[model samples]
Target: MAESKIPIYGAIGANVAIAVTKFIVAGITGSSAMLSEGIHSAVDTFNGVLLLVGLHLSKRPATAEHPFGHGKELYFWSLIVAVLIFGLGGGVSFYEGIQHIRQPEPMRDPTWNYVVLAAAALFEGTSFLIALRQFRGQARGVPFWEALDRSKDPTTYTVLAEDSAALAGLAVAALGIYFSHALNMPMLDGVASVVIGVLLAGVAVLLIAQSRGLLIGEGVRPETAKAIRAVVMEQPSVEGVGRVLSMYVGPDEVLVVVDVDFKDDTPTGDAADAIAAIEKQVRARFPMIRRIFVEASDAPGGDASAARPGAAS
Candidate 1:
């Protein structure tokens, strides 16, 4: 995910160029589609800044107050990104698009509009490819759907979604530019702007949904659970696992609580030794699991000890 940030930054850099160019082209041609594309690119620039902030904040060291680490901050900030997308990006574009539809302005110098769109599309495509390449390495060893379904790093997903939308929006912009040029109708440009707005809104909604899950402290993925269980159960002296609780507190960190039973009767000292061994094994197996709380199962006739006291029922 760290490496993936490079492409996101690159995409942001390119958007700055694209946005400025589009603004100039839009003003010169008076094409609503170009203006809308400019707005989309502008939002992308802001999203990049937020993504950088999220990437940094999400990596903060765990504190006494937040033993789970600062991973959840990624999701919270990402949720803010979604809200901005919806309110600032989507709302503004939607309003502008409606205005264009109501009183369509005739496009002037439509030829230049097409040229600017083509250039933007190329730049956006390049940025998108870089992001895809970055994600490729991170996504390996994990199922495609699973990576997206369980990933806690909002920067990667948000950038990917934003890049995809930018590419699509550029294509629509090109079409609108063409039609406005061929048919001498500027309303087509406005219609294209509306389409771009809808796309941004849709992606924003998705970001909101994902961020909400993270903020609420979603549990680990099923595959991750299976892996953790397997690791815990592999010790020869273990009888069976009683419970394995895991939650995402950050992008690459998890809080783990496990309960296990011993295979046979053992002395108090031996039980302590076994617990220590199990803790060491679990840590070695899961470097990503930063915090682990283990408790020995109750003796045959005794009550269980709490690993995480006051855990939700």
Candidate 2:
């Protein structure tokens, strides 16, 4: 969580520099593919700024008007990022590609496009590596895809996906420029621009799906819920476990409800002691779990008893 800002900051700086350089080179060469690369970099730069703003807004302290704090602000901005990519990056490139295909303008001084593409690749590659490292760290022992699915922090994986797409777009732009000159078919450059746009569109779709799921309140992973059950059941005072629910209130912050059956003969003092102990143990075991609701009932492991008011055994 502490390392979340690095990718956005790095990408912002790198994309800003690369965007300017690519625009200059595109102007010099008059390559449609080169111009598309410039536009891609510019869009990425803007997205980085949006992400940082989201991070800041998400950090706001909880108020009466917004008791949950502004954690979901990140999700809202991430969705915006997706829409922007689809509109500005993909839509514009698609329009430009088709226009260029019809016009078929020959590229002049194409060597400069190659130079700018190489530089952009280097910067994008570095940002991608940083994002990949953070994502791997978050995965822990789980499979990468599973970790991505369970992860509450969208910022890390979003950066990784965006940088990955950026790198791919840069490579496509270079190839398009090269093949257009080599084969003497200016239309190939236009095709390359369309391909870059397609790549961005795909990435946008992925980000949108992930952000939407988060906003809709996807619960804890099966493994995590299972672990929570084990922790509650292991306590001596617990007779049996019932329904256990987990919800993420923020990245690295979870609100949990664990229903347990206590021995009939257990005194109120004993139940209180057990509840306190369970809360402490669970919090220590999973730092992400910030709040817990443990209820006791006469019956064990039934939906009827799960919803019934809990009484002291």
Of the candidates shown, which would achieve the greatest TM-score relative to the real structure? Answer: 2
What are the lDDT figures for the candidates, one per model?
Answer: 0.78, 0.82
Clashing pairs in 2: none
Q: Candidate 2: RMSD over Cα atoms?
A: 3.9
User: For all candidates, what are the clash counts?
Assistant: 1, 0
Model 2 scores what on Cα lDDT?
Answer: 0.82
Q: Write the per-residue lDDT of candidate 2 for residues 38-66, one digit (tens) a residue.
A: 88889989998998888989999889997
- What's model 1's overall lDDT? 0.78
Error of 1 at 128 (Å): 1.3
Give the CA lDDT, 0 to 100, for residue 40 in model 2.
Answer: 84
Put down candidate 1 lDDT per residue, 173-242, tens digits, no spaces.
8887788778987778778888888988999999999888878877777776777677767765667877
After superposition, candidate 1 runs with Cα above 4 Å error: 1-4, 141-143, 280-285, 299-303, 306-313
Instruction: State every prediction's TM-score relative to the real structure.
Output: 0.88, 0.90
